[model samples]
Target: MGSLALKDLTEKCTTKYKKISVTKDIILLKNYCHEIANKSLQILEVNLNNVESFKNISEATLALTILINRKRVGDVQYLKLNNYTLPQAVNEEHIILTESERALSKNFKRVVTIGKGSKAVPILIFSGCDKLKIF
Candidate 1:
């Protein structure tokens, strides 16, 4: 009896709920947010700081991080400071990386955090971020 109900629920979700994506709209949003983020950073540098400007930059950062990494909100939001700022881990001798991979490795750093079911999840952050090179 319980299995029947579960099956019905799954079937309804599969048939009735359709996933849709608007690529054009998403691109527009990303572009707008990117501009706002850059503007906010410039304002902050000029010491024209305000709560509103800070909020806008923070929101933009969160949106870009999620979009770029295709990560869940929960996974990113709950990330600890230590986990995110940890030194980049180099692949051990057992791991083999292609030439392009080696070049890319110089650009980005990985941060690992615990996710659902205590699984390890990795997020990539550009290495220059610590040097204030967010853009």
Candidate 2:
């Protein structure tokens, strides 16, 4: 594939993604994904394929840079899937997107606490992913 402007790439991705039931919050994810796909040799490098059952949000964010930055700096390798279930509730979990909870609130399976002290924020809540990475 040839090099593409981020805007153009984002537009293309928007067009493609519109066909799916994917939520609008994932626009960030899609824009990043398209940027990575256009700029890298490995098409799937910046996709959610790196997400694993035990992976944390921070680690996944780092992986996404390789997947969406449009600069190929990392080796592309497929991650194995692990079956897991979503938790009903987890304390101190962070939900970055304000409205994410509404869409996936019922599907949470795990949580991660963030920042200083025990009183810190719950920075991440995740749904079970057997073989998918959704940024």
Candidate 3:
């Protein structure tokens, strides 16, 4: 009887899993992140219209952290940040920076203020998918 009960439970779980779709899961996750991003922006005194911006930043930061923690050397990742600048709080200690690249024609240099001090470090900032590559 115990074996029969276990089999029935397994079947129910399988059916429930089959009903779940990847697209739906992704949408749910994006919505959840949007909510959190909005709250974070409010705390930072950022405009409400920039909720999506914050979400993308959070996602990219997570991706970078995962790649660095995994020690995946030589793996290059790209992030797109159209016009959004890196927050003044981000520094080399926050995210591991290997290198950065840009054409000579560009006016803005990728740099971020570090810590409580006034010093700045070169940083490649990316938002959605415009022109930021991470190595």
Candidate 4:
């Protein structure tokens, strides 16, 4: 068997996603998902001791994780309680992170779980998400 080079096909090989306005569509999808996620969170927060509320919040959190991170649904569907925790990446003050960036970093909690291909997928959650209490 012999291999042939077809440089002429490179332009045609571009995926549709690369050629179209994927950003606009994806951003709109995420925006809609965010609204539902936020609503579910609010309901859960207000009914802290309700069992049904807990389930709704858990579902919302999972949906948010999958959407926000753009991971394969299978990747995070198996996460356990232990997977959630404070940020594992050390923030070095000397690295020159902007004040705004640093402030934003404080709100994210890091969760690494083994996903497809046995790779660790990091899921970042808002710090206050610890209140899920669904364990």
The candidate that achieves the highest lDDT relative to the unseen native structure:
1
Model 4 misplacement above 4 A: 1-51, 86-96
Arranged by TM-score, best first: 1, 4, 3, 2
lDDT against the true structure, each candidate: 0.71, 0.40, 0.44, 0.66
Q: Highest TM-score, which number? A: 1
In model 3, which regions exceed 4 Å deviation?
A: 1-21, 46-135
Distance (Å) between predicted and true CA of 35, model 1?
0.9
lDDT of 3 by residue, 43-112 (tens): 4464646656665646654444333233222222322243234434555643554335223213233433
Q: Give the Å shift of residue 114 in candidate 3.
A: 24
Q: Summing lDDT over every window of 10 consecutive residues in candidate 2, give the lowest-scoring window.
A: 75-84
Q: Enumerate residue pairs that collide in model 3.
A: 80-127, 80-128, 80-129, 80-130, 81-127
Taking all chains together, each candidate's TM-score versus the true structure is 0.72, 0.25, 0.26, 0.55
Q: What does candidate 2's lDDT look like per residue over 13-82, in tens digits? A: 8887445535664677756544553433233455546444224443444444333333233221221123
> What value does the lDDT take at residue 126 in candidate 3?
33
| Counted clashes in each candidate structure | 0, 10, 5, 0
At residue 86, candidate 2 shows an lDDT of 36
